[model samples]
Target: MIGARLREWARRHSDKGRYTPVGIIFHWVMAALVILQLALGWYTTRMYAGGDRLTAYQWHSDLGLLILFLAFLRFAWRMMVPGPINDADKGGWQTNIAYATHVVFYLCFFGLPITGWMMWSALGDGRPLYVAGLVPWPQMPFGGLDPQWQWAILDWAEDLHQMFILILIILIPLHVGAALKHHWWDRDDVLEGMLPDVKDADDHREGLTHKPKRPRSPRVTGAG
Candidate 1:
């Protein structure tokens, strides 16, 4: 009786919070940008040092600006919303890892782009990075840091950005694998909570609400 009542309460207050397309857009768009940036980073680092490409520097400057704008909005949105927490997760180790990785991911996404902006601003060229005659971008290692010191700092920022992302790639799979484990093995709703496509079409169609006989604590156990 006690357990059942607890569950009903849990259902009443489940963190199945609705998400804005901002969240949706931020998540995927950042993913796309990061992948593109990785490729661009490689191309520019080589091309700048002398490889072959028409205006590699120009492209890098422009893209860095794009990253800066997107990341700024993403972070602001994250602050406004209390994100959904999946119920299926239930372990300290896993939970901790997820939290840490997410924090790091945000840092990398923001830090890299911002630094690039600083670099460009510091150059004092005042020329905006653009492509095909549209879309303006800012630079990083922004002017005023002094050439000798600025060069070293830029190198550090570049190296740090790459290292964090490499770790990020590893974390991505661990996160997905854990969610899937809960779905198939535990037969839980962790995966259901995140599906843009309804995995629980039945429950959804039944009116998006379940009146559990009992309620559980609003406590969440895993990554959201």
Candidate 2:
């Protein structure tokens, strides 16, 4: 019953060509965390090996775990309440590609944190782990393993972590470009759906020379 109520609540917003507030919060919060993590990761790479570097790394790991936790919640939310169908949902190869891109993003959302956890565990430094420096987290069961195997795990996790990061580096630009194109060049509500308390250009001109008229009916009508 709760799930049904939640879905109905989400559907009301989705029908208006917007994401539910819960979904929007999850999206932007995770997005902010991800950008912060990327910047922190870059900063840590340049810092000399010392206490400060270790502190940075500790914070990074804490954030990664926080991301992992939020990702789980977000994924569950997604499963319970599907995303809105905006202009970008037009059925075509482009739409298919967009769907694939989302799948990869969810993979990265899960992959980065898991691999980072593995790497930290493999290091066997015996440092305590936490989620956002609050929730106590356990390391992977690597402490009992032999040194050679621990090294192997460390090497494997490091490679995977870098691979995920590289993939994100490539995808983020394209994603931003696509959103901007939908918003500006195409003059669509695709970007507005993810934005909070923001209506499409047609609803509020903001600063445009002339106000665009809103459509009375759905533009595309198929089960989203």
Candidate 3:
């Protein structure tokens, strides 16, 4: 009986096309972290210098690593349980564009932190990264280059890191705008699907004590 009830519950949820609870949690957590990291990155670069700059860099590095770890976990979860089916009524071009956008986001999520790590490693300044000023974080292996090449490699990595940041700066706003467009303009559940702790009217109706009435079938008439 328990197994049958669980199967029925799964069927009902799958039919509604909503994301699984794990997916919703991961999505929102990562979204908040990414936003925080971006704000920290922009503020630290613009406001701090000298020792203050180094301290800010430590925070930025710590947050970047955290994001990197979460990004991998989120990717794994996504692979384990696929997202909802795409809207069949939407045009092929729009669907393809959405897929491409997601691909770019995943690439950035992985790429930005890695380049930042490389930049720090290439510097070889011997300053340790302490997570929340507690545990010492491990440095990447690129720290031991010859003095002649160290600065050159640091410069390259720094450039790449900044480039990825710039890409994110552009892409994130566009992504948010598109989600808002779906929610407000198109009046769809695209945005709500990824959020937690809120259910749509249909979901509420599904949970009601009374059964819903079924619509009547139209009477068929033979053509003369």
The top-ranked prediction according to lDDT is 2
Better of 1 and 3 by lDDT: 3
Q: Which numbered prediction scores highest in TM-score against the true structure?
A: 2
Local lDDT at 151 for model 2: 98
TM-score-superior candidate, 1 or 2:
2
Clashes (candidate 1)? 28
After aligning candidate 2 to the native by TM-score, how far in Å is the CA of 176 from where it should be? 0.5
Q: Which stretches in model 3 have alpha-carbon errors above 4 Å?
A: 1-14, 86-89, 130-135, 197-204, 207-224
Rank the candidate models, highest TM-score first. 2, 3, 1
TM-score of model number 2: 0.89
CA shift at 222, candidate 2, in angstroms? 41
In candidate 3 the C-alpha lDDT for residue 176 amounts to 87
- Which regions of candidate 1 fall more than 4 Å away from where they truly are? 1-14, 46-57, 88-91, 119-127, 130-146, 197-205, 208-224
lDDT of 2 by residue, 85-152 (tens): 88999999889988998899999999999999999999998899999999999999999999999999
Model 1 error, position 79 (Å): 1.4
The models' CA-based lDDT, in order, is: 0.62, 0.89, 0.73
lDDT of 1 at 157: 62
